[model samples]
Target chain A: MSEEPSPGPVVDAAFFRRWLVAAAAVIDREADQLTELDSPIGDADHGANMRRGFTAARGAIEKEPPETPGDVLAQTGRHLISTVGGASGPLYGTLLRKAGKALGDSAQVTPEQLRDALKAGVDGVAQLGGAAPGDKTMLDALVPAVEALSFALDKGAGLIDALAAARIAAQEGALATVPLQARKGRASYLGERSIGHQDPGATSSALLLGVLADTAEQSAAGGTG
Target chain B: MKMLINVPETVVADALRGMAVAHPELTVDVEHRVIVRRDAPVPGKVGLVSGGGSGHEPLHGGFVGQGMLDAACPGEVFTSPVPDQMVRAAAAVDSGAGVLFIVKNYTGDVLNFDMAAELAEDEGIQVAKVLVNDDVAVTDSLYTAGRRGTGGTLFVEKIAGAAAEEGAPLEQVQSIARQVNQSSRSFGVALSAVSTPAKGSPTFDLPAGELELGIGIHGEPGRERRPMMTAGEIAEVTVDAVLEDLRPQRPVLALVNGMGATPLLELYGFAAEAHRVLAQRNVAVARTLVGNYVTSLDMAGASVTLCQVDEELLRLWDAPVATAGLRWGA
Candidate 1:
């Protein structure tokens, strides 16, 4: 947890803003698909819920233009909690706010700090939701992605490459939820019938990490692709 | 989708506006989508709050008034209300007597209420919660996050709201709420499905002669699907399932709830059958209510709830209530 200004690609406030924006774009594109996935086992609003939350989060960050990544994330957390309905709002809001506080007010982020912060976020979400990995929840993807990033960073992986590894891990983790019976959320109401359906929360969690990887790669390459 | 609504996005708000116009004793905070008592923050009285998705009418919103909930926060159809609305309502209605949240046992409602309670406490407002989880159809905890709270929610809200209105302290109100939740059990039967304004399609396609038994209020999959039976048979099955869990050998409050679109005549028929079934099992029904207190937005279905009651619970249940949904003794 040393804050000695470790050298890295600058994942500054601008990077965090881009991450939120990218998340909104991807979730909006997949909103219908998310709802479709939710139709069978849920109230059928996961996609619209995430889309509404991310849109508000994105709009908040863009409007205020916070000076630090931590500030940006904290703002996003507050907006999401207010905008999104259902369990996603509080759980995701806890994730971002806890991570933001863990990072402190550093204008930029180091890979080590990012790992710690994301771990804090994941832990906060677990605590808030009373869910663990293998519960067929967003934690399935989020926890593994954070663990992968931490593991890669410990072995001296580049920040962008670590994020890429996390993204892959998240996608795999999300896919792994397909065979598991839901033990959390609305799908849990279905009991064994919940099997063979991918969790919408896990799917969105994977989307979140994929955007983070894309943001890291684009920013590091000195191009905003 | 057969709906009497405008744009899907405005269904909840539009309904709130209509309620505000129709009920002079309630005020709707359109900005926050909360329905508050016209005279909220009652002097020396514990404020009560409860809410969930919009599809269940005459529930959280219609139950807001003089002797029921002090405020109700409505979400979109079949969705949990956000934490901000709950937090704001508690702050607005807290009169130093504290506030109690009657939350149903759903993942979304639990998390959001927990967050709201924390946020409310950070602002130095006292908040307590009573989570109702009385559906007894599913037995495995490994499969469900927990038992789904259904018809029992209405019982807890009314009984606890009576205690709160009598100037009971926060701890006392919450205790009474929990006690009500523990003594009740419910079972639902769906003869058809509903289309929320937002979804614009039936929740699940029920065949011509099939029905879903032990269904949740959200139209979530039931315990099983079988051919639709006669009204008396359906009533007996649903009522029997609840009585098995309730085990009410003494006096009980029987509620026969219609799932939105069922007719009054049909509800009465179901109610008579439920009463007969309970009597056959030696459970005395002291008070009976048959209406659509908790609904699934025009789904043709019915649910039966039985609450084992002692003298104290009967007193509370008979207390004057003037909510839009239930008005009588007042």
Candidate 2:
């Protein structure tokens, strides 16, 4: 049991806002890829849905800048819930809103705070959608992210390192959904044919977590300034 | 791969603007993406509200007016509207009588509408909800959720809206809507895939000679895919599916709807085949409407809806309706 200090930066309201903006950009950049994946199993609007939802969320955040990290996330959640029109909107919106609500009026979020916030988000999504781990939804990615965050927090890692671990876990979880048969939403209608395709919702969720990881790392290193 | 949309985010808003300009009598809420009767909330009359994603045009929006929906909220393409829009629309349309919400069976729509109803109830407004699950494609077994709500929704909106306009109590209006849902059945097939505006691409890949059967309103994958067949054959299958689910022996109202990309000529041709099939089966045809009432972005497909009509239903059907998406005189 070696005692090694975790290396990372603190996350604040500005970082949370950046995370959302980056998430929108990431969705825009990967919109075609998402559509391509969706063409096989769905109506192919995954990319369009994410792009519209994130763009609207970003615009809302910019229009009314939140004073606290929770505020930023809450506002983003509300925007996505209202503007995006599919299952993803409400699921993601609930995630953000619950997380923001957990964070309350805090300007900065510690690793434990983020872990609790993520748990809140996960609980919120589960309540809203009734989706489980193998349902082939964003929950697949988010569940793993929350788990990884909790693991890092338990190990006494800092916010940045914990977020990085969560990002990796989310990416792996997103990839895992490719081979599993979809059991919820429109894709479930295909039955066995839905297998072997990456879920668009999981992919976008992974992107969001990855961007948050990057922002946390940057802030930790004082590179955001 | 086939569509004509400028920007994904702007499509619904721009369309509402164009609709407002074309039909000045209807009021359009560009910000909230709601269309309402110019003289909304008739005194002492119950208000009716319905909405869904943006791609299904002339649907919720088109049915908003004198004898139909008091207001319709438009969500993003293939998405359910947020609670804000629903609450706002409910508030806008609520008269002294109350408000009736017409929601499809989709999970998102059901959840958001429920939230909005709660919000409205909190504000001391009476609100009731009716869920439409008319598509007979998916089974309502324990394994799967249930059949989706589809083209039959148009009939419910029209008939229920008429009932509401006639000063039916909220309970009666909801009951009428529920009866229409129970008596109706629908099925659809797609010749090609539709492209969403934001994604700027098609939702699914249909080969040049293949078709998808039993598709949902949101371009969800259907029951099966087979080599392309003639319009008569497609209509036969669609009618058979609907009839199988409905087992109708009485006169029924029929709607052969074009799913965005299909032309009027094809719809009429399909309708003719459906008429023959239903006639051969001894099911009386009370009324018929063949057009693009609800649509999936640019998907090339058509859905057949059959609603068993009684005397009361017929009277409601013939009631006056005037709105941006639909129009007819008393």
Candidate 3:
């Protein structure tokens, strides 16, 4: 049999746990910034929403550690839906729940599987919000990030490289929203006046991918995300 | 938080708990944070349910008695209630005639209510929905994915609730709600912003002499900001916008609703000016109202909604009704 080099570290329950913890920490630290970003275009609750949602996820994980990687994500998703209010609650909740559900009961997650699960989550968010990429929403960041992650992985990039690509794509996508006029969410009410402001939802989506990438890198070294 | 709340997390539940005791005529389900008429799901009458974030008090809750809403599902402040709450409220209030949901057009409100409607249907309860998007301040806003629902929500709820109370079929009540939405238009102006307890800061800063025009109930920014104007100028701008949108040649019902923190004395003065402006445009104001009926927390502003009312809507508007926030000819 032809010898094939081993791939990067597999995403297991521990990886997801660490990933969620990292995500929560990042959100907690950046809450005010997110809220400030939203004040000009939203209800000024994005940061607070994320803080509450991720805190609930963290608390739930601590109280009842989930069994499978999917279970951990699913629990976190459920908690976000309940504790977080506003559009962010249902939108982000859908993302996690869809991604988690896509993982099924698998004990180990391949890079391809993670990529596909993430796409599923992105699809769910778009469908629920009825938003498109240029709508200046979280999808702006998420769609590009998911596309980049899958593209990089399919081209034989390592898991760490793929996550890095995704994070960069997400960040760039968030920045690109600065010139766009929102067509969805409360920002849409501003219409043309909405231009010149970075979309808060996109900014948070970038934060999400940033943590995911950081977790992947740390996981390679047997460290926390 | 500087506001009068035990804690940020406890705001919704605690206020609802107080409401339960405060109004024996209403049944407050603190477990799910729903308020229902004590005689909810009354036999053969079609039940009406409406709710959104909780900060807009005396709305879905205070209007949860008599000829308003049969049930009100209050979510956390400015956050739409979850599907579970709405589903439970629907199940609890649905009579054989079916239940109707009066939903604001905010994206969160629409999505959550849509989910609950599906859940309610799965449980064998018939349901219909009416989306009120009457705010002409901006076609869409940060909080609203489409047209923001504002003061017109009160008119739709009250009028439709009255129809359902008189044993109107679900379709008729839904139609009434839709008509009210189509015929009504609203605009608001804010002198300041309010702080959510969670944020512990004003949503946005408005320095002296500047005002946010076309504001909504969420205390989000308005369409434009301008120097502070005289009450007469404010009245003229608000009324002119409403009239332009509706272009009503017929008599209309006028409601001047205050954002929270506006004094009644100031509101009445503003209302008088708005009436004068409407008359200047040769618009006949058949009915007029002024109050803090619909609010946006502590945002100091007011919105004006004018509806082209027909005989049917007029009769419904005059119907005897009793609620914590509204009572007339009861």
Chain A TM-score of model 3 versus the true structure?
Answer: 0.95
Residue A186 CA error for candidate 3 (Å)?
0.9
Local accuracy by lDDT, each model: 0.87, 0.84, 0.87
Best-fitting candidate, measured by TM-score? 1
List model 2 lDDT by residue over B1-330, tens digit each: 435667565788888888888888778989877888888778888999999887888788888888889988998777788888888888888887999999988877887888789889998889999999898878633334456789989999999989988999999999999999999999999998777775566666778999999988776778889999998899889999999989986789999999988999989999999999988888899999989988887788999999998999999999988776677884
Per-candidate TM-score against the hidden true structure: 0.96, 0.93, 0.94
What value does the lDDT take at residue B178 in candidate 2?
95
Worst lDDT 10-window in candidate 2 chain B = B139-148
Superposed on all Cα atoms, the candidates' RMSDs to the truth, in angstroms, are 2.9, 2.5, 2.9
CAPRI-style quality class for the chain A–B interface of candidate 2: acceptable
Each model's DockQ?
0.66, 0.48, 0.48
- Native-to-model Cα distance after best TM-score fit, residue A124 in candidate 1, in Å: 1.4
Q: What is the interface RMSD of each candidate, in Å?
A: 1.2, 2.1, 2.5
Query: Candidate 1, residues B1-330: lDDT per residue as tens digits?
Result: 667888877888899889989998888888798999989889999999998888899999999987789999998778889988998889878999999999998888888888889999999999989999988876776667788888999899999999988888999999999999999999998988777665678756678899999888887878889998998899788988887777776698988999998998999998988888887888888899999999998789899998988999999999999999999789
- Steric collisions counted per model: 0, 5, 6
Per-residue C-alpha lDDT of model 3 across residues A1-225, encoded as one tens digit per residue: 013423566689988998899999999999989988887777777887789889988988978889888888888888887767678888998899999999999988988899999999999999999899998999999999999998988778888888999999999999999999888887787778778999999999999999999888888776432
Instruction: Give the TM-score (vs. native) of candidate 2.
Output: 0.93
Supply candidate 2's per-residue lDDT for B299. Answer: 83
Candidate 3 or 2, higher lDDT: 3
